[model samples]
Target: MARTSIDYEDVYQALPGMVALLTPDLVFADVNEAYVRGTGRPRESLIGRYVFDVFPESVNAPDAKNSHHLRASLLRVLATGERDTMPLQRYDIESPEHSGDWQEHYWSPVNCPVLGPDGRIRLILHRVEEVTEFVRARGLGGDTAGRVLEAELYTRARELQELNTRLREAHAREREVALVLQKAMLPATRQMGHRRAAVRYRPAVGALNVCGDWYDLVDLVGGHRIGVSVGDVVGHGLEAAGVMGQLRSALSATSRVADGPGQALNVLGRYANVVDGAESATVVTTFIDFDRHVITYSSAGHPPPVLLHRDGRVEFLDRATDPPLDARPEPRPRPEASVAFSPGATLVLYTDGLIERRREDIDVGLRRLADSLSHHRELDPEPLADTVLRELLPPGGATDDTALVVVRL
Candidate 1:
């Protein structure tokens, strides 16, 4: 069936959007009142005229986009049997009723083939929509995105600040308990005339703030040796600290009977494995016998103590170690290594935290500590250890906690 042309004047007045019927080559076969008002032209000027000639605004050379890509889009529909949307400019014309000279417009151009009495495509329908007010009224996409980002940043900052407060309180409380418990498990601070001790403890860095590093010195009756040790139990928090306390207690009691470095560590390993009636893994330990001339030491997987000789030579001294005491049902046999102390030498017994840094760049930190010890040969053990902790370790609290036992020979 053919689409008979209704009364053309009545159909023109009925259209809501700017509507027109075009020939295959852009000749205007018919148009509506809305199209006349949008283009600001008299209806007589447009009817039966070529669309390009009447509305020069919508025409462009084949290579260039016209004012709003209106000409190109109509060409696309004809070539591809498709429709396209366009925003304000040439394709859309403003209504005469609106006062604002500025327009925000959109064009939804549709080309439908109108059949003739012969029943094949004869004319094409082109519809243009003007949505100028809608476009101009809203904010820019970039501006809206910035506002949302700022709001999210504010939320994140608030969450971070609250977390920091909670962390500080929790860490302060844990450190208080850990410090008191750790100090109580060992003998009271006593300075042996032959040995001056300097100890420093700080919480771990970041929020967790737990450490399990401990050291002790017991003055033996025979003036035979200084019973010094450094030990690490397991992890970074209170559990490691608690295990350290149990081991420290066991070391103080057992060291009284063991005469040699190897014997002392053997006793410690056995006791740590069985303490509290539960057999567990062995903690790595270093026990030192500091007599005036020579220092004998035994280790259980602990890093060797660095000896700072009075002549500015540095040496890390320790024996080959078996695994930790509680690693198995039966502990690996302990080993001992001895070195004669350089006159006025300072021995540094430390945990991994002393040299370890984030990103595993411990070699650089080791060199710094070794260089510091070599450069400052005359500084006493107490001040020397303090300086190393303050300068060589990462600033503020450490990523892992550090413990140091400095004995001078």
Candidate 2:
């Protein structure tokens, strides 16, 4: 067999379906040949204009609501980053042959978001199947009874569509509430003073932007010391987010008073035992003393932090590791370790979502993380954080929540 390369642009242009690409703000970016022919507009004319401006609702049919429904669907896709299938819509397009006239059209439309590497919506794909001929045929029979039956069916469909819209609105409201709660729990990252640092939190795609991952950076009592931690609770949605908040707060408070990272996590483990949905949670904490040039660290069955040297050497801080929170029936002291780093070295801490992949050995994921850090060791903390995420995350985005923290010594 011979191998052949495919030109995706050619395929997109040759697609039989009417398709158009629009910016997140609804300006047209590109249109397929079918779309140009279907709308009776030239490709050049349609490419740069706003979708509604190019296909305005007919003034003759004021009640048609052609633009209103389509705009609503596209906006929903933007808000949720999910595909939206709209019910059959009655739209009127300007007649190409007669400039002053409008022709009735019916369409089955779907709007979808094209996500970027960071999981944000970059573009909107709008595809529609013209159904004007089939809809007209439903009323073409001379029999009065046939036309009346078709009308009833169309009314029933419209009612169902309205019901679906209501349900979607309800879901959106619930997601909004959950998102607000999560944001309230996670504090914004503050300035790291002499040491530079960056933090990023990404929730799972299609999980309503709520998950169990969390990261915290706290300024210790002394000006030269700071505490940084990342953790993952065992579930998703409101329950996991609530547990994560509680655990993170508990750890933060313990770190402020405890003698070391081990003592802080031991206190957190005891608190986790009483909190529902906190069992088997994994967390890693590190307290950096800039004056001492030391990093004291402990992990509760979480992945080890990476220390990337300026010479492209990577070190995994895994000497002190213990089981997850509430894993042991009897409370015992957690282990802690300390490592020294030179100036310009970087410290990277993250949740499992940064490395783990479905059905793959964890060592491979760990190696991949180390390789990325070694290659990009020269970048500063902020760009290092962004670059690591861009390289480590799956193309469609992580299925689990990810929290990342990067600091330069």
Candidate 3:
């Protein structure tokens, strides 16, 4: 048999699938245009770099397992002279153009070894086919397959359904684990001194990601004062949840040493800036002094706490509005506002997620919350919290986590 020389590079680069040629030492020798586009990286950035260095896994979460499995598969292909096909894998990429923010990417990949003239493995061929859109389509499809071969269509459709079902199950499991973790971090219905207290936490519906919304009730000054707080970190997933946990712990520790909400929040803002990826957080902290019959509170860009008067009047503690924690390096003073509460009055502290809607302005949500509180003022603190959440979220539910703390004097 006679063989003719050809421009293999032209064919390789023209292939629709993303393809990369790597050296035996795992450095990228060449990457196709498709590969460059898929990675959102330039040829110069990838051609000389080690594969793992260019596409490192996320250490903070949501994509750590994806990085581990992909690395393992590539290593396997390098060791054994067989093609390794990986199932759909999530490999979030950090785009320099996007200020080094991580972006979601899903791929079905195969790695194979290319041989030299001596039959030694000299190069590795990495091929990746993006299946994110296809997976999403399968998840969004109706019952019918439109017009196609019934049997083959049925088989493929069933496979898509199975994949979708598996994804949903995995999401459910992840949500349950995150919820349990979040619950463990919070206090389990403890008495905040002599005040009647109740708390509610509801993660976003069908949300696989863990966000940073938390509430706490802690005793201050040997049970002479009660410290209550609600806080929300800026983003979602494990990193945000981790920050929330740290902030709660720090707040608990700081509140014990400080004299009032103003001093406590000032210290907390400095603490939040030091924690990794804790860009900003909103917090509402209140100290109820049972002996003095006064409640002093502070807001670090958090929504104001609603006060339901014993005579059915409603008011918002809209003072001491500072920027969110971690917003500034210079520690500015956080002001504390005080208001005396009657014996039957109620106080409500909540994250923005409780009242915020996707389409409407936040002020509209606030008005609705105020109205709801006015109507439900006669209810117990626990039932009042439930009523507020039900009225705001309805049966469909909200898109962000909701954390609420209610206290009755």
Best by lDDT: 2
Q: Give each model's whole-structure lDDT.
A: 0.63, 0.86, 0.80
Instruction: List TM-scores for all candidates, in order.
Output: 0.55, 0.62, 0.60
Q: What is the TM-score ranking, best to worst?
A: 2, 3, 1
* Pairs with steric clashes in candidate 2: none
Q: What is the lDDT for 28 in model 1? A: 85
Task: State the TM-score for model 1.
Answer: 0.55
Candidate 3 per-residue C-alpha lDDT over 9-40 given as tens digits, one digit per residue, 9 for 90 to 100: 78888999999988878899999999999988
Indicate whether candidate 1 or candidate 2 has the larger TM-score. 2
Residue 101 in model 2: lDDT: 85
Give candidate 2 misplaced runs (Cα > 4 Å): 1-167
Which window of 10 residues has the lowest lDDT sum in candidate 2? 140-149
Worst-scoring 10-residue span by lDDT in model 1: 58-67
Backbone clash total, candidate 1 = 6
lDDT (tens digit, per residue) of candidate 2 on 369-395: 999989888888888889989999888
